[model samples]
Target chain A: MLNIENIDVNYGAIRALVQVSLEVNEGEIVALIGANGAGKSTTLRSISGLVKPQSGKIIFEGKEIHNFPPHKVVEIGISQVPEGRRVFPLMTVLENLELGAFSRKDRAGIKEDINNIFLRFPRLEERKQQPAGTLSGGEQQMLAIGRALMSRPKLLLMDEPSMGLAPMLVQEIFNIVKEINQTGTTILLVEQNARMALSIANRAYVLETGSLAMSGSAKELAENEEVQKAYLGH
Target chain B: MLSNFFVQLMNGIALGSTYALIALGYTMVYGIILLINFAHGEIFMSGAFVGLILVTVFHVHIIIAFLGAMLFCMIMGVIIEKIAYKPLRRSTRLAALISAIGVSIFLSNLANLIFGANPTSYPPTKEILFPVKSFELFAGAQVTNLQILIIATSAILMIILQYFIKNTRIGKAMRATSQDYDTAALMGINVNKIISYTFAIGSSLAAAGGVLVGIYFGVVKYNMGTLVGLKAFTAAVLGGIGSIPGAMFGGIALGIGEMFAVAIGLSSYRDAIAFGILIIVLLVKPTGLFGTEIQKKV
Candidate 1:
């Protein structure tokens, strides 16, 4: 339920995104796959209002949101789990989750949701009072996802959640992402891990440099010769 | 002689509590935004004037006047942040620092123009809080009821502030903002509002310190904040610039150290002694006692 149309973004002299366009329909896990500097994160950042585009519009559920700030974007049911997890380093795990629902006013629902999250991430529950920075890589990734879920966003834009994790933890995170989609939350996942991302995504787009290079069903893209050569390393 | 020494210690505590009150403002603002808020001392100075106007001009009760001064300074602090500091937030740290110094100069001059450069003495304490009374300890050492009032009130306010920072939802938001500004905004925390709230709380504490100092020392001057503000800043840095507990400890330590210096026949070097202690402490621990070493990610 989100449409980004021909948005151009720049960082002074460097062009980060050049007329980039993409879309995510409701209940679909849309994966944006690219290499190190292929503008995947930039696209997500523009949608989240962290980076304002120079042209074109970002339509979320039919309203243009290109002018909104990061907080306003969250208020409208779009939450972003930023690159590097970015959890409050000094705060307890529970407090991090509490801040995730900062825009909500339902006290009882917040308490219940926190409990639900604790059940889902039992390791976090065990260290509920511990500072988030002390969490291991895998656990911090879980905390980041859990924190995003706390906001109850209809659309969760996650950037590089699988980065810096062990291979086993990466598999676990991919499984959790699929499970989250099964529960009906639309996801816009930006990742360099194309193989795992394509395996779980309903639809996928390949970004080369700053523009969309290919788009198709996950299965078709996974089998495409050029995609296999460039992204999947087959 | 020993009892007289204890008497000086008590007086030092009374004075130190006032410094601690002002230092809290410094530490909290620095913790969140990393700006020194040099104008804060002027906020404290304005607090005394606010108390003076309420007491002398409006004839309000001392308790009400104290609260009034705090409320007035809280608003002033927020306004100063909105006007002076907020615009410079996105600029370099140097720009914000320069803006702070400018605000400090502007505020002090404004106060000087309004109240004149002369020092104004507070009304007699006997007419304000109950009749002034004294208690005698061993060796003819004495403590006034007003001294007890200042010390007890400061303690209670500090406890309340500690509770606020530790337990409240807004406080949690503040902690989050201080840790990561963008992440807090992504979580839908209005970071600007949190910053304003910080200024309000810090300014109010400084105002409370100002009123206490006005009553304790029996005089308020346009530039009273200069030395006291510097010492409070030294205290904040000495205790660990951004740590709440560190600010409290730093203020009290600096106050007691100054008094003890005076006691040991070093009264001529009183101000120099405060900075000297700060320099030595900082040299030993560059981050101050509570400041965490900045962790660099490769």
Candidate 2:
């Protein structure tokens, strides 16, 4: 479980996020949907400790992790797949996955997890030795997800996994997210793709210009008026 | 005579090994941080001085003195990282490079003040490395035990270094970070810690190279590493600025090239030979022999 309460974040003097509160229970897929410029990604970054909140707290499990460094946040069981599919381009596809489990200790488990990811993304398995930059966008997204899965995170934070994917690939990526959630790992997904996000989310929050606009069960939020016009294309 | 040729070849190996070691420092640091640690040579020189002072003042065992040089250089390397590098991590490569030059001048002048402008040598010794049997390769042409040791030690260190980079945990982290920094941090790798370790290892290797140069050349003096470090950086650039194996190849090639210049009766141009090769390589293949070719997104 995770709790982010009344967190404020800024970029130097410019404020980025106002007091925003959100929570995700264990075994849940919580989607934060918004248009461009929403503070969704910033919120995820704040939890991951990349953005030091101006004055707010992010509690992962039971510990206060606001002051933790970016690396320490991952060590504490939250893995982030950043937007833009920024895979380590020079590294081999396999090397990228190996870095995912960097702080892990169980050697056998690491190997097993890699095999599982390869099974999920067979295309990656086929091009294991190739440089990641050579991968197609969809394959790179798969690799990004596979790399995060290698971290064995208890809670996965994804920022725009479907950002640049084809329509069919978008559904495939979301299905994979659902599959990952079914395995009992909690996920906090942030996306501009609201219809698909709320389509699969257990609970959803609408982030609008650095503020949490609304929160409800996925079905109810899908029928909400603003959510319909702004995000769902209804 | 054939003897002269064999002697020159042995000397080449000795010089090549030292260059290879120093070049490793340059390439490793450059690979991880994309900044050329120009003061690397000063670090090597400082190692030699530290070892010399320790041996002369305390009468420490030669082995311990060499290792002490390594330890001292390693710590100094970490200190350099803290002061010279970490602050400029997010800055432009040009700034970091200028900072490295600043560090270079600072250390060199500091040593000049403390040790004086006069060149210092090792404490008077009855024996340097044990003089062993000289093997006659040709009539009156011979390889002494010291040259053999220098060549052998350098080759061994290069081999060990190759193994360390290719197959180690921290090595992987270094490689990962070198390839992608933000992603490495996402995996919980302390990127700065890995970089500090790189400098420490590189400086340690340079320390060993310093001691070997001291013994092989039958002298240890301040400012020795200046020429050697410059040549080593040339080697790094020649082989590929950010490639480890490239450094070794570059170092050895420069060494042999320098010796070849001397052998060809152009000893005055010995320094020029290394620089010449670097220029040619950069012009022809900007990414040295072992360097990874990167394509920038248009």
Model 1 chain B worst lDDT window (10 residues): B289-298
How well does each candidate superpose onto the true structure, as a TM-score? 0.95, 0.88
lDDT (C-alpha) at residue A97 in model 1: 95
Across all candidates, the chain A TM-score values are: 0.99, 0.98
Which stretch of 10 consecutive residues in model 1 chain A shows the poorest summed lDDT? A41-50
Query: Residue A210 deviation, candidate 2, in Å?
Result: 4.3
Kindly list the per-residue Cα lDDT of model 2 for residues B1-298, writing each as its tens digit. 6778778877787788789999999999988887889999998888788877777787787778888998999999999989988898767789889999999888888888888888777644435446456788668788887777777877887888777766777877888777766667888898878988999999998888887776565566567767889999999988898888889888888888789789989999998888888788878988988887754331
List where candidate 1 sits over 4 angstroms from the true fold. B137-142, B294-298
State the DockQ of every prediction: 0.83, 0.67
lDDT winner among the candidates? Answer: 1
lDDT of 2 at B142: 86
Residue B92 of model 2 has an lDDT of 79
Best-performing candidate as measured by TM-score: 1
| Candidate 2 lDDT for residue B268 | 95
Residues B13-71, model 1: lDDT tens digits: 88888888999999999988989889889899999999989999999998899999999
